[model samples]
Target: MRRGMLSIVLGLALAATACGGSGGAQQGGALQGQRITVAAVWTGAEQDNFKKVLQAFEEKTGAKAEFLATGDNVSTFIGTKIQGGQAPDVVMVPQVGVLQQFARNGWLVPLSADVAKEVDANYAKVWKDLGTVDGKFYGLYFKVANKSTIWYNTQAFQNAGVQPPKTWDEFVKVSQQLADAGTAPMSIGAADGWVLTDWFENVYLSQAGPQKYDQLAKHEIKWTDPSVTKALQTLAELWSKPNFMPGGPQTALQVEFPDSVSQVFSDEPKAAMVYEGDFVAGNIATTGKKVGQDANFFPFPAAPGGSQAPLVSAGDAAVVLKAGKNQQAAQEFVKFLATPDAAKVWATAGGFLSPNKKLDASAYPDDVTRQIAKQLIDAGDAVRFDMSDQAPAAFGGTKGAGEWKILQDFLGNLSDVQGAVQTTAQRLEQEATKAYGS
Candidate 1:
């Protein structure tokens, strides 16, 4: 089956419908006595925050709230429950990439007209559009975080006598400088394929800009395009640089996101900077360091020929299942989630940036978090979702994973640039063609 561009099933389908919109249904459809269960993909401190919100909801509504928590295998559990006919009433998913799949399979209901209208009026059209597929708004998002930014230790940069780089050339120079200073310039984890994908997507955007890259992923343009090849070539240079990356490209596979983040603050911290989403701040805080005071960020630099880039971001969406047994309760829950109060709760509690444009960001205690929020707002229409999560899993999943492995191998053998890229481009084209036939 050639993966249809519109049918690949990515996007935050669960996140979209989690909140019923303004006109979804006021306060009375069917949830009165029915116990509403919530299934979440978060655990640990994150899970506790969600539990608190659910508890608050239960206390306010007098309904029993049951939670099914799965940290990493959530999608598997969700798939199993749905297939087994024991689907939960509400589910929160992190990206629209996976949610689009669920929605295509009829796993979610579109946001009711009342709810849809309010969402359109209140938030940026892109976010609302992210939740809408086939003209149906099926998801709502409370938080959005920038992903294509670099986090650096301020004092470290001060001591190194270099400013944060704002262009790819400058970034390369800084990497060399840090290497000279015996510091791991980049806390990169290429071992984890997704980390490499992050580097690829940012480079692609910085080189090709969003529209063409979007087109390439959708198969409107070929992967062999000069821009994509250029992007990959640039990434190859970074990965190939001697002592340029921490723990080595192979380390990416072994390093978890937190491990990569903690390295930025380690006493003998392997690296002086990290490139990841705003969410890394949470991972850093877990290591007992503070964001803003102890850390700061700069947008990834622009490619030589690329236009000014948009901020790359990712976040979860609250979705209401189409087959949910309690329509009224689910709808009401959606409404509750859209309120300013809900936005505040999500930001402070979940360590996320709220999607509610009207919320007072000053309420956030973390300066880094607040600055991120302000950056998003100031960038306004320039924010784009994480490219991997925005594209189909084939492009962003296994095949994408395969691309990273090839890069890792090539990083160790820089002399094989053409050979490595030629082989990778062919493989990617074949997979994309199979998944998304021309």
Candidate 2:
């Protein structure tokens, strides 16, 4: 089956998440004396921030929401729990592939009438459409990240006398100008395959347009298709220039994601920019540069040939399990997750973005984050989910494998030669065939 779009499962589904209670009356008494268990991979500050959202749910509904850490293997945790008859009542799944699997297996419960209604009104059509799978709604996006923003060092831009560009050709020119001014233009974290995938996704989305983006994501079109080849060649415009990067491609292969962000935002920055999602701010937090002042960003430029550059984004979605003991309570918890009240809990504390359109701009801690969050809501139908995340897990989600590994190799082999780029695309198609088949 084709996957659901980035999804609205948008309104509150489980008001407080799911109560671990043994029984429940209706949505009214769903939370009374119940403890709902929600599983996700968030830890450290991300985890602490969400607890506040859960607490808000608790305040409104008399239910206890429990956090279940699934580490990076949420699928494994859910599978194990299902076998043992101890599966979590609610899951905030980051992988769309896993959600599709659960839905296909009938393990998921559709959103109740009230929950669906709230979602319909609170979210845009794009979110509403993605929420429904084969005509039944299942997942509600809780947190969102904009992957189309390119964060640059404010000092780097000022010293180089370059302004943010609006098209790919202009962006390439600006990057060269930054290099000419004696500062490396980019901090390419080729060490993290997902970062490379994001770079590819932004370029591809802008250059190839949505139809081809969706086709490639679904493997409806091969990776070696002309559209993909064109995207790869465009990326080579920057990736192939060794001097444009802090340590060139090979040295970049040694730098991980956090270090990449740190390198650009440091006291004495090594490069002018780093590209990733809004979550890049999390890594920037550990640096000396302030986000809005010392660090600022612009939306990635559009393609040269008049193609649009839309939002490429990702986030966790809340879904309830049919096997959960407190089914109505689980529904209420998810419903609560869709509200501004719940979103504000995390938004104010930092490092969180929501698809809840009703959420206010002031809820965010800073203008940098508020602007980022606004893009997600404002893009409406112009947004696309992270392409790799929409594909099967073996192909899209694993570490050192599939899209991650193939893109990593492609990053290492960056060149202006058309033939080399085509070869990498072929390799990607070959691996994608196997993973999607499996």
Q: What is the C-alpha RMSD of each candidate to the true structure, in Å?
A: 6.6, 5.7
Q: Rate the local accuracy (lDDT) of all candidates.
A: 0.68, 0.78
Q: Which ten residues in a row have the lowest lDDT in candidate 1?
A: 1-10
179-276 in candidate 1: lDDT tens per residue?
A: 88888788876555676667777778777876786687577877777777787777776776778767576565567666778888765678889888
Best by TM-score: 2
lDDT per residue as tens, model 2, 30-88: 35566788888889998898888777777676678888888787777788887788878
Off by over 4 Å in 2: 1-30
**Where's the lowest-lDDT run of ten residues in candidate 2?**
1-10
**Candidate 2 lDDT (Cα, 0 to 1):** 0.78
What local lDDT score does residue 100 receive in model 1, on the 0 to 100 scale? 84
